[model samples]
Each structure stands twice: as C-alpha cells, then as structure tokens.
Target: MTVPRAWWARLPDPVIDAVVVAVAVVDVLLSLVDASPVEQAMAALACAALVVRRRFPLPVFLLTLPAIMQAIVVAPFAALYTLAARSRDRRLLVACVIMFALASEASWLLNDLTSDDRTWTLVNFFYALAAVAVPVLLGQLVQARRDLARRLVEIEEAREHERLLHSQAVLTRERAQLAREMHDVVSHQVSLIAIQAGALQVAATDPDFKEGACTIRSLSVDTLDELRHMVTLLRASGGRASELTPQPTLADLHRLVTTSGIDAELTGELPPGTSTTAQRAVYRTVQEALTNVRKHAPGATATVRLWHADDGAAFGVTVTNTPPTRPSLPLPGAQQGLIGLRERAELLGGTFESGATAEGGYEAILRIPAGTD
Candidate 1:
C-alpha cells in the first residue's frame, strides 16, 4: 500500500504558523511581567494571523493593529510582515498608512507613561517606520520584476510573428516564380508539338507522312523528359536543405533556339547562371513573338539575338519577325505568357519591351542584370 504525504508538508504553511505562534507566545510571556493576560491573549491572536498574511492581508492588518497598541512586542512586527507580503494596491497602501499612524501614536502614548526622553522616542519612531516601509518596498521590487518578465515574453512573441511573416513572403514569391517557369517551358514545347502535328496531318496522303508522325512521337517523349527534369530541379532546390543538380545556364541558348522554330544569333559573352533567368525570359519572349508571328505574320522568318556585356554584368535578348503576306488574324487576349515574362524581368530588376519595328517586323528586347542570378 502507498502512503500519502501530508498537505502541509508540501505547502509549509502549517510549519510557518507554528513558528509565528511560538515567537508570539514567547513575546507575550516576556510582556506578562508588566501587562495583563488579556493583553497577552490579544498579541497571540495577532501573531497567529500572520500565517494567513498572504491570503487575507487587509483583515490581518486591521485585527493586529489595535492589538499591538496594548502589547507592542510581537503584534506590530507580524502586521508589518503581512503589509509587506500583500500587493501595493490602493486598499493595501491605505491600510498601511492608517496602521503606521496608529502605531506611531500608540508608541508615543506608551513612552509618555514611562521615561519621557526625546531621543528615545525618536529612536522608537524610526524603528516603527522601518518595520512598515521595508515590507512594502520589497513587494514593489517583486512586482517590478514580474512586469519586466512579461515584457520580455511579449517581445519574443512579436519577433517570432515577424519571422513567420517574412518566411511566408519568400515562399509566396518562389512559388510564383516556379509557376512562371513551368508555363514558359510547357507552352513553348506544346506550340512546337501543335505545329508538327498539323504538318503531319496535312501530309497524311504523302509518302513521308509516316516519318513525320514518328518524329512527332520522338519530340513528344523528349519534351516530357525535359519537363520532368525541370520540375524535379525546381522542387528540390526550393528547400534550403535539399541539394539540386546543375541546371541549364545561358550556354544552352543554342539548344533553346534550335528546339523552338526561331533562328538565334549570339553576339557577346554570355555569363553563367544567367541562362536560367535568361532562358526563361528569352524562351517566353520568343514563344510569345512566334505566337504573334503565326497568328499575325504567317510565313515570316523570326531572328533572335542574345548579347552579354559589362564583363557579364548585364545581358540582353532581342527577337524580331517580319510581318505576314496575308492579312492579320485576330489575336487572343492577354494571357500568362507576356505577363509571366514581364514578371520574370521585373524580378531580376530587368526591362522587357515588345512593339512593332520600322520594317513591319514585331520585336521584343529583354535587358537583365546578370549579377542578379
């Protein structure tokens, strides 16, 4: 069988009360040589109230203040202890002032009946003041410490909230960037697929129609593989802890132009890592330009020029296509392609401009800071 411990053993309230009562009994016994048993009994009651000082401070102060006037040895100190332990609210302060006034007056009155020396009365008055003020001062210090702790906790919580908001903003921007890349890669490939499929369908009665179909299937498989690789790279590198494979840089512009229907010309030194941003930007720019060409400039040849300067400090891309022989077809409304390219350029603190050239050709120029990569 398990035995339970006494509640007072854990709390120590009972032991504290016992000690206070013992001291009060001893003080009462010493005062008995001059005072009555009734006076001693009142002092004992006041000392006992000290045990519950923290719980019922005001009541203890009121009960003990009058008793200390008759038996000054034990009751006054116990009342001072209670006053010190209680909070410095209006009620507690008021009670302490009243008790101090009463105790001072009582000391003067008692000393008048005994030896009436001015110096001795002054000494007793100082002791009475010290007893009352010390406890209240200690309580104020404790309250100040608690207030400081609360402020520290609030500051920590505010910093945590700010960190969370910053992280969320970064994640939101990264996801938007990823969506734009995926759109550029997939849309450009799909446009080529549509063109090849159309060509195969038109030549269905021709002898080489089966070979064109086979080429379309092969291109489709290659497009899917590139899409999967890009997706894996984007997702893996998105996290801080994940290691990612090297991605295609500006060096891969030749492959990008060849894959798309545009003929590209490189003029200056292309910087490293600018390829990812440049590729996405140039790809989307050409993709949109080609789309406009097919819709508005059929049979027009598109020319692309990529240049890097400032020792790879900056890079620029230009894609131009002549106007079609036939009348212009009505184009679709503004969509993700142009908007995504503009966003990508803005992200790198770059500029994107698309308009009609003097010779009836549509042109797009993207100038980006290579150091941004």
Candidate 2:
C-alpha cells in the first residue's frame, strides 16, 4: 500500500515537536523525584497530552490548564506554539495570553510548592510568563516565513507555465512562416511551368507534341488546385496540424476516375453518416492508388471497391489495377504514398494492406473504424 504523505515530513515542525516530547518526558521523571505522587501523576498526564498536542492543539492546551497546579507542563507550550503559528484570528491571541498567565503561575507555584518566599514567587511568575511568550513569538515568525515560501512557489510555477506557452507560440508562428514561404515559392514555380506548357501547346503544330503539352497543362492545374488547398489550410490554422477542408470523399471517386482518364469501376457502398476523418482517408487512399495506376500501368484499367461492416463499425477501400500495358511514365523519389496511408489508417486504430496479385496486378487496401458521434 502507498504511504499517506505527511505535510510536516520535510519540515522543522516534526523535529521541534520531537525534542519537546522528549523534554516533557524528562519533566515527568523530575516531578516524581521533587514533588508528591499526585503532582507526579499530573506531570505524567501533561507529558502524555504532549503526544497529541500538535494534532489537537487548542483542546490539549485547554485540558492542560486544570492540571497546571502540578503542571511541569511541556504540552501547553507546544500547543500554544502551534496555535500561534496556524491561527489567524485575534480572539485566539487574547485567549492565548490569558491561558499563558494561568499556565505560567501554575508552573511557578508547582516549581516552589514548599517555599515560603512571596517576592521570589512573583519573580518566578514573571520568568514563567516570559518562557511561555518565547514559543508564541517564534511560532508567529515561522508562520510568516512559511506563508512567504508558499507565495514564492506559486509565483515560480506560474512563471514556468507562462514560459512553456510562449515557447509553443513561437514554434507555431515559425511553422506557419515556413508553410507561407513554401506556398509562395512552389506556387510561383508551378505557375511558370503551367505558362510554359500553355505556350508550347499554342506554338507546336504536331498533334503528338500538342497532346503531351495538354497533359502537362492538366497535371499542372491539378497540382495548383491541391497546393492552394494546402496554403489556405496553413493560413487558416497557423499551426502544424491542419484543420480539415472539404476533402474529396468516397462520393467524389467518380470524378477522380474521370480525371485519371482511366477505364475504371467503383462498387460497394459507404455506410450512412460516415465520419469526416474516415471519408477523407478513403478519398486520399483512392486518389493515391489511382495516381499509381496512371504512373505504373498507363493504359490499364483499375477497379475501386468500398464497403462497410454490417454493424457500421468499420469502412474500407480497395483499389486494384491490371498489369502494365508496356513501359509507362517514370515516377521519381521514394514512394511514400502507401506508407503514409498505412500510418493514417493505423493512427485511427484501423488497418491497410497492399501487394501484387497472382494475376500480375497490384492491389492497395485500407480500412478505418467509422467511430460514432
């Protein structure tokens, strides 16, 4: 079992009270030697009361008051000290003063029970009052110091939290700046490519070269459309994580197939009220798969299939394409499309599968949980 944490475990309160408990025990012993058995009993009771004085300060102090006639009293001082340090009301201070006088007089009377000296008793009485005052004064100082320490801790914590928030704000602004720079630079370059393609289409007389230029122009327009969408996201969110725009969903797969200029078929059905995230993931998967078909299989036909679990807990997309017609369009760089798609699926607690079929065709499959609202 875990131990309960004590507030005073790291504090002087425990150490100070430990020594005081020891002193009270010693006083119990001394009273047995110097005074009557009745006095010794009272002293022992006072010593025992000291054990809980810290736990039950005011009550223990008040209980110790009647026993003060024989009180060698260590408990009362400890109790008064606790009260002084913890209590805020002025009424308790007045009570402490009155109780302190009573305790002091008791201590003095008990100290010289057999003495016949009146003037000396008064002097001893004053001495006892001074002794009681010491802990009260010390307790007040300790309380003030503790309050100051607590305030310092709160201030430091607030400052640390503020610093972290400021650092995050700076990082967000930097990311948005990087996105803006990329939008400006890449958009300019793509626009130039589109212009050159348009010029080539106009200047060229051969049908073959003109067809190539038109394809180039089409691809350029599509790229610019995707780029503008991204740039608008960066501007809107101003953060690393982009807020979703109107991403193409399963419903838009027909448009995607037409744009790919491929012989294609789509089948199966999307569940009613499918989630936005699942819809986006399905669209991207199909889009990327169709792009792959265009690049690697050129004139070959592709089929896209989408389905939902009977219980409406999961939705899926599968894109498969026939083998290449011949040597096709060259694709550069590492192909991160399917890898990125797999990550997106897994992040949503879903799955992705892709491989070449026995028929010499390639198939890419993605499944994502259609979580309820």
**Candidate with the greatest TM-score versus the true structure:** 2
Cα lDDT for residue 305, model 2? Answer: 91
Candidate that scores best on lDDT: 2
Backbone collisions counted per model: 2, 0
Q: Candidate 2: which stretches are off by over 4 Å?
A: 1-19, 66-73, 106-127, 183-185, 206-219, 236-373
TM-score of 1: 0.44
Looking at candidate 1, the ten consecutive residues that score lowest on lDDT are: 240-249
Candidate 1 global lDDT: 0.65
All-Cα superposition RMSD per candidate = 25.7, 23.8
For residue 95, give model 1's deviation from the true position in Å. 5.3
lDDT of 1 by residue, 1-373 (tens): 2235567536677777777668877776676677677776677677777777778877777767766676454555655555554454757675676567556667565655545566666677667666666656766665565554544554455468669979976985696478457757774676578577766766687658766776776777677667767766665655433244344445555665566544434444446565465666665666666655554564577777777785767787788887654333344466566677788789879988888889987888888886665
Model 1: residues >4 Å from true position, as ranges?
A: 1-35, 70-86, 90-98, 104-107, 110-119, 184-373
lDDT of each: 0.65, 0.75
User: Clash pairs of candidate 2?
Assistant: none
